[model samples]
Target: MWKSHPKALPYLFLSEMWERFGYYLMIGIFTLYLKDVEAGFAMTEKEASDLYGTFIALVFLTPFIGGLIADRYFGYKKSIVIGGLMMGAGYMLMGIHDKTMLYLAMTLVILGNGFFKPNISTLLGNFYNDDQYKDKKDEGYNIFYMGINVGAFICNFFGAALQILLGWQYAFMAAGIGMFIGVVVFLMGTKHYGDKTEKKGVQEGDMPFYKIVLFILLPSVIFGVIGWLIKGIQSDTNLDSYIFGSDSTDAFIFACIPVIFFYGSLYFKAKSEDKRPIGALLAIFAVVILFWAVFKLNGSALNTWADRYTDREITGTTQTVFNSLKLAKEIEYKKDSTELYDAGFRLQKENGAVKKVVDYPIYFRNVKEDKKPEEGSKISIWATNLSQSINPGWVIILTPLVVAFFTFLRSRKKEPSTPTKIAFGLLISALSVLVMVAAVQIGNNGTEKVSVWWLVANYGVITIGELFLSPMGLSVVSKLSPKNITSLMMGGWFLSTSIGNKMSGVLASLWDTYDNKANFFWVNFALLMFATLLMFALLKQLNKVMKEKGIN
Candidate 1:
């Protein structure tokens, strides 16, 4: 894969692979860990998804600060290493099983990711600044993207096996180890990016650090707190008392307002030549919010679909094969065990604060009485986290095919522009949700378990969309961003991702509200189609801007 590409590509690729190995490993099992009841946090689906959304949103949000800091102070290499260590330690600490410790762990990962995520890609983008690599920028991002999914694909297996053979704690510790390895890999290749990762001092047109702190960061904190505390109109439920579904969602959305304003300010503040490109990037960013909202459901809403509604039972020859491969494990259907865990539902949050929710697994509720296993009998079922691997699995399988297809188009001089790819990507992804609607119909709305192939096929279809949108988004930012503000604009891209991720959480938190599961997916379909239409609406103006910028 490194043939004829930048030498830095492999080092960055390997470093990113390990980094994603750690991040995705933890995330793959995060909700399962939260809802474990016996050994973990014992959160309800709503509680877990709310936190999950916030965590990922912040995980992406910090890149704004991280990118800014790297651009002006710490070099990308230093920031990347610092970020990696913090994240590794956080992952290790997650195993301690105390609420305060968990919060501390999460804080470390959040801060670490801020330092790590955007700069590494920015560093890669820097490599392509040279004339020799300029035309290959999108291809490089696609290759880099494949590295991310490779780690994402492999880590789930490790997470699953460790959680099975040892425990969640050990599994988390392995994530730390993966991160450490990533740091080591990056260090070994410092010579490649060390020179390219130059820090840019604050420029005349740029927002100063103090102003950013006052206007964007501090205000975000205050706004978040206000969003958390303010009592507003309610629908006879505390969850709906605040805006945007939950307190965290409210906080996250309100917090983003200032930051969103900051990005919009960049356009108004940009040099004349830079204004159109920034405008184009912001427009695309606005539309992709709907894309990430649906695509990121893999961990929450879709995970639930896999867990409760998907038929995961293994028996006879299939059971023998799964047992041999350790792909599935025997789960003893002990009603007493479920009741015992349910009793401890009011356990401490990560801050040692008490948590309360409706205490029930809801896992057994949908099983047909006659089909239910005899009490205390063990039956083999595929791992819940295994479902998390489906999307990345598709990424690994389909990336080369997508790349080849596009390469063929490039050779024919008929390749869709980056904006065009992204537009189609949104359309294709919208269609993936209909697959779940079909799954819901097939499962009789969770009364029966549907085939695992429904999830697999859905991921397959959407993976093509991912290949189109995600890497292309990175390429667009790298191409369109003004040289001095590249990291900040990259931060803007992640800011959009943060909001969308938070939105995904809000959507997932509503999973129980709809009596018909198909209705939930229909809402997803509608959101994506809306995004698709909006993207097309802006396509002409966006292409004209790209042409003016000489990006293609």
Candidate 2:
């Protein structure tokens, strides 16, 4: 793959792979670790999911500012190094196990991601700007994306092993170590980043940075404070009257209003020639929000599913292999007793008062009589967070095939434009949710432990949609954006991702509200379907712009 691409491709790819390995490894177990009563914060599902949503949202959102700063001030290489170190420190600090330290650590990771994520991606696209490699931009990004998932695919095993053997702290430390290694790799290959780090001086129509800080960031902070202070003012329940879904949810949504308006103003005030392309970007960005909203559930609602509902029981060859490999987590069963209940998900009292009751594992209600453990017997099962690997595993397996398929399409003049690919992606992702709908029915709405195969099947289908949409979003932004604002537009893509990520949290926090369970998946399906319809509606206009820009 690097044969025709820049020589830097392999090193950048490997650096990113290691970075994502650390990041995903930490994220794979984030919620599970947060909810662990003995070795964790023992937060409720709503609390943990809400926080998870906000964390990832901010993690993506800051790239807007980070990209701008790198474009004008710090070079990409310097920004990336700084971001990596900050993230490494954050991951290591999270192992301290204090709530205050946790929040501080999350802040560091969020800011670090802002600086690191967009700049690295921008640098890759810069490499492809040359005439010789221009046509292969999409393929390059696909390859880079595969690197990310390659790391994502393997990290969970390391996370699972360390968490099981040493503890959550050690697992987190491994994440920090992985991040540091990525930084070292980037430094070793600094020579290759030369032309890609050009500073884009302020363009004619750009807003001043001070104005942005005063009018945008300051208002966001004030709005966030208000959102937090008034959480329970309207409803007796602490959650019901909140602005979005939770206090953090409300704050994040409110804080984004000014920034969202800023992106809109760019199009509204653009010169006539720049208008069509910016409009196309904004429209596509809107639709893809649904995609990220669903995909990000891997860290929230889906993690809950893996932890509570999936049948993790391994037997015969499978059991023996996992056990010998030291990848399984052993949980002792005391029937007619409730250790698992307390260690599992729970609901809050309507008044936000602490409820002593431990929520039942949605899985236990339906275990086959034969499979249910003897009242006093202990059961050793695979860890729930280990299920997080499925999608990345699919990515690692399917990337080459998908790339080949697109290559074939390109050769035949049959490949869709990026916008069209995203439309189809949204529609396909809707179908993936339907798989979960089926799983819910088959599992009797978590009355019994569903086969791990159900989770595997769901991820497999979604991975196809992801291949169609996710990397294409990056390629689209790089292709259509004004040269000076390329990184800024890339930030816009991540902003949409930020919004969708927060929405995923909002959706995940409501897991208990949908007693039927299938209704939850159905809601996700409808959201994506709506996004698909919107995309198809604008396809002609978007395609016209793509043709005008000579990007397709």
Candidate 3:
């Protein structure tokens, strides 16, 4: 893959691979660690999911600011190194096992990711923009995305194993170690960055750094405070009446109003030649936020599914293989003891009744009748984190095929415009949610352990959508953005991602609300369908813009 591409491509790819290894490893069990009741923090599902959403949302949000600093002062390499070190330190500190310390650690990771994420992606695109490789830009990003999933695919086993053996803290420390390793690999490729680090000089219509801080950043803080203070007045709950979700979520959405306005103003204020392209990019960003809202459920809602509804039992031949690999987590059962319930299935009861009467753990709902333990008997089961790998595994397997499919279309001169690709992506992703809806019915609303195949199939379908949409979103911004505002536009892309991530958290927090379970999947399906319709409605205009920009 590196044979004909820019020298920087391989280094960037490997660096990202390692970085994702660390990131996904940490995330694979982040909420589980937070709500472990015995060994983990005893946060309610709503609390954990809310915080999870906020953490990941901020993680993507910071890249906007980080991208600006690198564009103006820090430069890509220095920004990446500093960001990586900070992240590594944060992950290590997360092992300290204190709530305040965890918040501090999350703050560091969020800020670190902001500095690191956009710069690395921008740097990779910079390599592809050279005349020798410009045509391969999309292919290059696809290859880079595959690298990201390779890390995501493998990290869960490490998380599961470490958590099983040494507890949550050591698993977190392993995430830190992986991050340091990524930094080491990135530094190993310093020579490759030399040509691509050339900064674009100031261009017309660019806002000054101080002006941006005063107008956008300062306003965002003020808006967030106002939102928080006014939160509960709107809803019956002390918090819900204020916004669609939690107070933090409401505040997050309100704070983004300024940032969103900033991006819109960019289009309004751009030079005439840049206006149409900016408009097209903004439209796509708005619609694709829906796609991300569903896709990001992998970390929240889907993670919950694996933890609760999915049958994780490994037995017979499969159990042997998993055990030999040291990848299986065995859950021991005790007679008359209260069972394990992850945040997803926990419920509260009113009217002075015991909330949880049956001692049966939630996971047993789906165990095969023949395999389930008798009353007052004990049984062991496999690890939960390993379920996180299914989607990334599909990405690793399917990226090449998707790339080849597009390549074949290119040869016929029938390749879809980037916007069209994204539209199809949303449509396909909607179908993946439908698969989960079927899984819900097939499993009889979690009365029995559903086949693991359902999770695998759902992930497989969605990975195709992800491949079509995600990297293309980045490539579109790089191609469409004015040189002076490229990083800022990149921030817009992440801003959409941030919003979607928070929505995913909100949705995940509602896991127990839907008694039918399939209702939850239907909600996801509806969201994606709405996004697809919006994208299709604007397709002609977006295509025209792409044509004018000569991207097809």
Candidate 4:
């Protein structure tokens, strides 16, 4: 894989692979750990989803400051090392099983990711800036993206096996080990990236560090607090009364106002030669939020689908192999005591009287009584987190093919521009949501178990769109950014992703509100479709800017 790439590619690849291994491993079981009534934190679905979304949003959000700090002071290597160690500690700390410890651990991971995530990619972008490797930039990012998914693809098996065989704590410990390994691998490759890793100090007209803190960062914090503490005039539910569904949502939105202004201010302040490319990037950044908003449902709404609606039971050879590998666990069919609580399916009164509702480990609340397994019988079902791997799994399988397809277009001198590809990517992704819409109709809207193939198919289709859009976004950022603020622009790309990810949480939190799940998918489709149209509307102007900048 590194044969035609830069000398630095292998090291960056392995480091990122291990880093993603840890991050995805933790993410795979995070909500499950939180909602496990027996031994875990027993949070309700809304609460868990809220925290999960907020955690991930902040995880990406901090990259802005991290990128700035790296650009101005620490450089990529030092920042990355610090970030990796912090994340390793955070993952290990998750095993403590206290709420305060959990919050503290989550804070570390969030801060660590802020430092780690954007810099590595920015470092890679620095390598591709050379004329020798410039044309291969898209291919480079695609391969790098594959490295990320490789870790994402493989980590779930470890997460699943460890959680099933030992405990969540052991699984978390494994995640920490992965982070440590990533930091080690990164150190070994220092010589290759030494030139690229230097701190990029501020250039002429750039905002001073203190001004950015005072004007952007400090104000964002104050705005977030205002959003959080202000009482509503007349509503009962706090979320409904707020501006954007919940306090976190409102706070995040308010906090972003200054950041958004800062980015816009960049275009106006840029040297005339740099303005159009920056403007084009800002346009693309805004449009791609819809993509991430829908795509990031993998861990929440989609996980719920796999848990409740999909048929996970296996028998004979499949069951034997899965059980032996710790890919599946036995959930005994019995009236699980009230102790086996899942708040999403907790008891609700009916007929003016209260009755005991046995919420079992298996999500069988909507399953017909006759269709359920016999009491005391054991059934082996695949781990829910295994479903989390489907996107990365598809990425692993299809990346080479997608790369080859684009390479073919390049060979013919007819390749689409990066921006054009993103427009079409949005279109294809919108179509993928239709697959879920069909799944809803087939499963009778979660009333009965549906074939697991539905989940597989949905992921497979979205994977194609993901291939077209995601790394291409990275490639464009590398291609268009001014030399002095490359990492800052990279951070801008992820900042857009951060906002989108938070929206995903908001959307998933509302999953129970929809009577027909298909409508939920329709909403996703509409969002993506609108984004697609906007991209096309701006395509000509974007292309002109790319030509002016001598980039694709």
Best by lDDT: 4
Per-prediction CA RMSD (Å): 4.9, 4.0, 3.5, 3.3
Off by over 4 Å in 1: 1-3, 130-139, 191-194, 203-205, 270-273, 316-318, 333-377
Which residue pairs of candidate 3 clash? 63-114, 234-241, 235-241, 329-383, 366-448, 366-449
**Model 2 per-residue lDDT tens digits across residues 43-80:** 88888888999999999888888888887789788889
Model 4: colliding residue pairs? none
The residue-by-residue lDDT of candidate 1 on 205-274, one tens digit each, is 6767898799889988988888888766877666467767778888788788788888899899888999
Instruction: State the local distance difference test value for candidate 1.
Output: 0.86
Expressed as tens digits, the lDDT of each residue in 365-409 for candidate 4 is 656678788878888989889998899999999988988888899
How much lDDT does each candidate structure score? Answer: 0.86, 0.84, 0.83, 0.87
Candidate 4 segments whose C-alpha is farther than 4 A from its true place? 1-7, 127-140, 191-195, 236-241, 268-275, 335-359, 368-370
TM-score of 1: 0.90
